[model samples]
Target: MTDGPTHYPPPGAPLPEEPEPPRAMTGGTRPPGPPAGGPPPPPTPWAPYAPQGGGGPAPQPGYLLGAAHKPGAFPLRPLTLGMIYDGAFRLIRFNPKATVGAAVLVTAVAMAIPIVITAVLTFTVGLAIDASGDVESEISTADAAGLVAAYGSLLLSIVLAQIGVIFVTGMVAHVARAAAVGRRMSLGEAWAATHGKRWRLLGLTLLINTVFLVLFVVYVVLWVLVVVVSPGPWPIVAWGLITVPAMICLSAWLWTRLYYLPVPPLMLEDVGVFGALGRSWTLTSRQFWRTFGIGLLTVIIGSIAGSMLSSPASFIGQIAAFALPEYAALLLVLTQAFALVVQNAFYAPFLAAVSSVQYLDLRMRKEAFDVELLREAGIVS
Candidate 1:
């Protein structure tokens, strides 16, 4: 060994130590003291708090936030009943041409078809009754058959009206969904979106209506039994007092639970009728009272609005009827038609918008659908 350079430590000189690694300054560039202001440090966007009871991690700072801060047709959060109501009106206000025009077109067709069928059936039945001589005389077999045919035609017209309602509802729902996310959809666009789905929507409506019809028939049968087959008055009175009310309550409850549940999935998810129903049932689970209360409130509000709009037409009709008694029947028909058109135009969109908002609200609470909606709107990456 060559003892290179013969280097040695000087006497009393401390051995050089490795330089200490730099410390991470808690507050960069500031003295080791509290921040200058009394206000707390801003929260770290990445920092997460533990949930209470150690259930789960708390939501991240921006995770639950909605798409944009700007107010749209719907707020970027879970909706209140009031918000839903307001949103419904806002949708109508935002897109009257789509909402009102679609409703009017569909409702006019629905009303016209039924009215024409009913009129023709009535005229035919009246002629037959007249041919049978005295109108108030006992019913003959032909007259009975004619009456049955007329009533059956009327029933069919009613069914067609229901189908038309389903079509209009689907159309309006599409428009409402577009409006909710700050989009404007034309009536044609809405109809096109719902074009292939109307039959399925109609099927769903028929299914629901059938359920209601069955309940009504069962109620009527029970009532008949209570009146005709019961031994005494107390039973009839008891049945009327208890069973009827119970059935009515049950029907109302079921209606509230189901009425708006399927619209969202049907329109947005593009699901089949039965699939939509199942999805709706799943979404509505454990939230029956909330959904029911919102639905009932929406119905009452829409009904009041429709009544108010239609009342003016009715009042004017009454005035005309009194002023021109000879043309009273004609005025009555025209005015009633006008009222129906007005009611349908105004209330159809309103009900559809309410249902759309309710559906969106339900999905947000259950599925965090706001995130999805925001993402789709490109508000969130």
Candidate 2:
């Protein structure tokens, strides 16, 4: 072929162009087509090779490099116990003005109204009782009637206070729910959410209290029967040995199963009293132990915190009493009230947050609430 295109070109001549190789063998290997033995392997779609160790795809960077993902107010995944507690505190921290401020305002108003009413009634009744000036041994019918009226007024005040508690709890539940969905609420907005639901919450509270009261009465009757009607010391001892522990266990169980659980669905879902109760019962059915454990832990923590705060407040109150001996009683009452308000400021939101988080967690376990929340937030398709 013309001396095979000259093994070497003349020293000054431009290098001759090399002939093109076959297209199939261009890269020093034949282009892939059919397997050697079998019909062409089913056409395999091109795909990137997996990383060597078979791990998941690399994680995406967050808003800041190396930062953990923050989907919303909380992580967009099922929560752990620690996460629940953390979320509770975070809810308060995220909107302390709404959560803590509202609690303080509501509690102050609630407590103040009842205190004023009771004080007025007590003052009026005391004046009447002193004016009568009845002998101690022979009490007049008017004095007895006045005493009954005073006691009735006290009972009414207590009921009103309980209703106020229900209202405050409903308001806090609304705030907690809003916080869960990454929304900040104002006190007015929370109040609006709770406005129509107050009566229902109060009814639920009354119903639960009535049930507990009935149970307590029955227990007391049983104890009386065991102690008085039974023939011997052995029966009383046996009753004490068995019923005391049993009642303690029962009370603990009831507290864990029912307390604060219905409030979330009641306020969030706009469910009625009985419906909320049913919802709570259903949600807690299979998760009793977990719920109980979490409730116990939260109560312990709250108790410890309350003790820590209240102790200092009590000490300060004692010091105030000593400093202002002439107004010792007044100072003691004012300081105690101040301390109570402060304690409620922290505890109320904390308890509400715990209840709201627990409600979300239960829904997540049973109904994949995290997915629903993500979908609602437009984080997932």
Candidate 3:
């Protein structure tokens, strides 16, 4: 180093001056070019591709619905028939006297349609028979049976149509509860929801009931043919062995397939009739037995309740030696209709609510539907 300073020919020739001590690299006085030794900086934090908001995200219906899919997931916690009882109890608890009063009011309003129809049809036919009686002075057995059968069929159809409407109303109640946020729903909200989907619901009921009615007609035809062609006990035996099971199975299959066949999805998704049918079929296919048992139980219970409600009218008719048989029959018919409506009231919301719950369950199980639901609810970015 000393020799380089003494023997340097010129300032630019051979003077090195110990290479400038390698130029220390500090944060403030670091070299302008590459650093001597330094590790790369850490990468940035992960930022979700989500829109910014005050809250992280809000809960979605789909995600809340997803809770139904887990191994023992019940849309209503502590699930059982008791749940239905509890729900109905809640309806009354809100306004003790008013709730029962409202149910009675609605029931009375609904019953008037059928009651009027029955009374008018009875009087018209009675008058016709009376007019014919003047010519013969006696009613033939065959004519009497024919009149009774025809009237029964007419009344049956009317009853079914009214019952179908009540089911539709119940469905609307379930949908309202499902779509609610932050709180449970009341009958008023349920009625509001019912009103919105009333037309669509009635249309669905008509389509499904029409199919069932056609099947009933076929069953009737076969029964009549058996009677006409083979009056022997063997025809009865054969039908019992073959037709009964077939009818039962067919009814069960159809009932299970269409059980929850239309509802929240129809309301929520705005699906057409066939699409709702298809979705219901898909959802119930795997759990047919469970559905069947549930349906069978419902029917049995409903029948029992309906019978209890209706038993009084039948007993009264048999006991009373009334001067006017027609008036007595009218009383029985009205009582039966009122009882049926009450029995129906219990099962209506149960079926509708369960179906809606099962619909969401299917979506959750098959698709990662919780994700979509969360996205919709704004809970997930």
Candidate 4:
């Protein structure tokens, strides 16, 4: 493992700002071929992709990143489904602080806006609905506005949650990429790297949401056409049975192809939103089933696992509510929030890990990536 007293830059030092020729994986530069019996470290997740640097005896940009170091989590070569799963777990276990800890922080912050908004509305509006449905309170303008504000907050929370997922996935992806190279990112480094690309990632998130919305609008139009043309129980049933399932399939296909693994490219390559989109789409080509299978299974497993963890809290919350009915509303809100937090603590990071690993795996398989001069790049110790 030792590169012969190579005097590798000690681990934990600041990564060099100037581009190492081999470290830049995007230019006319050719990487020194793969190390004997090993793959190269992946391209550093943080690099300037704005323009190619020129030659003046100084190094140029664009090099193959190697995953060749004794993998902190996963090997650099093409990976199997089980290996990807194993690597995600290994990453969480080996780098708990950056993985689980960062996940917790992101979840809490993201949830905070909704939680606080709900709490204020609940206390101020005083639980607008009566569980028994016996109240006949007359409506007031203030109450109506409060109701609108409450629902608006709910909608805002949904948007925030999606943004949170994207942000945290990118953050965890940054750490996971480093781990793939036998390195762990400190919390500070993770934030610095991920936050630097926040606006670009946010723009991507917005674009993705808009795409899904367009799909929804299409589905609605088709449904309207079916209803107007056929207007029968059978036609309705056919729409439900055929149209719905087809739409679901389309969404799944699009998820795996278009937006699933763009974070690493956005971070590793100096691309704007559209560039990352195209890069991710290209990387996932011809591996549709493999990527889809892995992603679908991961989501299913994460859901089951999250439910198992969250169930206990919910059950206990119900029990507590029965024991103290006076505080039922407050108790229910807290319980739901806690359950969500519990679920996200593990699921979000796991998904992000799979994403980062797969991104590198694809690079190795499709682009022939290999790391040659990691020490010279100022990060191999």
Candidate whose lDDT is highest: 4
Q: For candidate 4, lDDT tens digit of each residue in 18-87?
A: 4343354556765566779898755554343453565344332222233233336775667887778888
Q: Name the runs in model 3 displaced over 4 angstroms.
A: 1-105, 113-164, 167-176, 179-182, 186-188, 222-240, 310-341, 357-381
lDDT of each: 0.69, 0.66, 0.53, 0.71
Arrange candidates by lDDT, highest first: which order? 4, 1, 2, 3
Candidate 4 off by > 4 Å = 1-69, 113-158, 231-245, 372-381
Ranked by TM-score from best down, the candidates are 2, 4, 1, 3
By TM-score, is 3 or 4 better? 4
lDDT of model 3 at position 180: 23
TM-score of candidate 3 on Cα atoms, chains taken together: 0.54
Better of 1 and 2 by TM-score: 2
Expressed as tens digits, the lDDT of each residue in 89-193 for candidate 2 is 887887786677876665565445434543453344331222233212133564455445544544454455445556666776776666655677777787888
lDDT of 2 at 202: 79
Regarding TM-score, does 1 or 4 come out ahead?
A: 4
RMSD of each: 16.8, 16.5, 21.0, 15.8
- TM-score against native, each model: 0.69, 0.71, 0.54, 0.71
Candidate 4 TM-score versus the reference:
0.71
Query: What lDDT tens digits, residue by residue, belong to model 3 across residues 1-55?
Result: 1433232131123323333223334456533543557765444334333347655
The C-alpha local distance difference test score for the whole of candidate 4 amounts to 0.71
Error of 4 at 185 (Å): 0.6
Task: Summing lDDT over every window of 10 consecutive residues in candidate 3, give the lowest-scoring window.
Answer: 128-137
